[model samples]
Target: MPMHPIEVDDDVYALLQQHARPFVDQENDVLRRLLGLDGSPTAVANRVSGGDLRALIDAKLLAPGDELVHIQTRKGLTHRAVVTADGNIRLPDGSTYAKPSPALKACVGHDINGWGQWIHAQSRESLQSLREALRERQAD
Candidate 1:
């Protein structure tokens, strides 16, 4: 494949950096992942191999397509995201985030603890609590 160069602003570059896997993802890899161009079997396998939410799914704590909700009383806002088959969080607009924090941050416009804030819509349980339960199970 031939490589081409394109220019992006600082913010765009930073966004790519945030989504990148440290030391493992080059710029093209990050771009491919973010752009949903990594749909090949190998790419899907690599993507699903590991992630925070993937662990939860493996433990049966969260199922794929489960909705996670965040309520910001101060801003009078409610945001929703769904867990993808590979454990990524997918917002309604079709953007997928690899981690909870960045997923919530995209909606809230600031840094927040997504594990504590994003509630499982059906169970009304915070992800943090679920994580704790998974931890306890593992420790046994």
Candidate 2:
């Protein structure tokens, strides 16, 4: 899709960022969602609900209530989220994300490799490491 650029002042830009779903939502997506132009609310819900966390949960790599932390050292920011029983990620803002990438995006306002960025709080391991272990185990 071709994207067009538009300018907004800091406040308006911050507002747009506040309503965005991180990596999942571009500015247009947020505007569309807010204006009810993104189809049925059910469709919006479905879009946010599908994620990769369930595979980790099923493989016993992560448990419900586990905390994940993302630290942007250069930016001096640290964001945290918890794993839900259903394998969704629950952000501090009380929003649940089905995947780590969008969850991390919600924190940093851009895309980053979530599997590498989110640290398993207890283990101090990256989600990427856990995923690799799971893959290795499955291949065995």
Candidate 3:
């Protein structure tokens, strides 16, 4: 097999190292596992629904009842959602969505990166930013 050199910043390199399996000697192997290409095709998406947000709650990345707001730039209406006790998301009108994007679409009437658009009430940052912070902490 041939090897290719890819450039990564310090943070990404740290993330790869943090996720590298202990017994993996090759960088490719480590990267494969980190990327969930080591045989689990649905691993990344599955982990998103289960582990990622759960870990955030466990690590206190977000608190229950934390409001997630999306401001519709065109409509000029602010949509609000709350994180439930069980980590499910509930929209302003009492409708619930398991994922953020749908909830955001329901709120704002458009498709968007809910993770990037939904602002965390406390942190005043996007959910995407918060998730990145959680991943960064794991890397450390």
Candidates in order, TM-scores: namely: 0.68, 0.64, 0.60
Better of 1 and 2 by TM-score: 1
Choose the strongest candidate by TM-score: 1
Estimate, for each residue in 1-140, the C-alpha lDDT of model 1 and write its tens digit.
89999999999888777877778887788778665577755346436564468888988889998999999899899999998778778776545777789889989999999999999987899999999999999999
Clashing pairs in 2: none
User: CA shift at 29, candidate 3, in angstroms?
Assistant: 50
Is 1 or 3 the stronger prediction by lDDT? Answer: 1
Over the stretch 1-140, how does candidate 3's per-residue lDDT look in tens digits?
Answer: 58899888999776666655557445676666544455553344434564234556778988878888877788787888888655557654444555677768776677877888989888899988988998899899
Pairs in clash, predicted candidate 3: none
Ranking by TM-score: 1, 2, 3
After superposition, which runs of candidate 2 have C-alpha atoms over 4 Å from their true positions? 1-50
Assess the local accuracy of residue 135 in candidate 1 as a C-alpha lDDT between 0 and 100.
93
Better of 1 and 3 by TM-score: 1
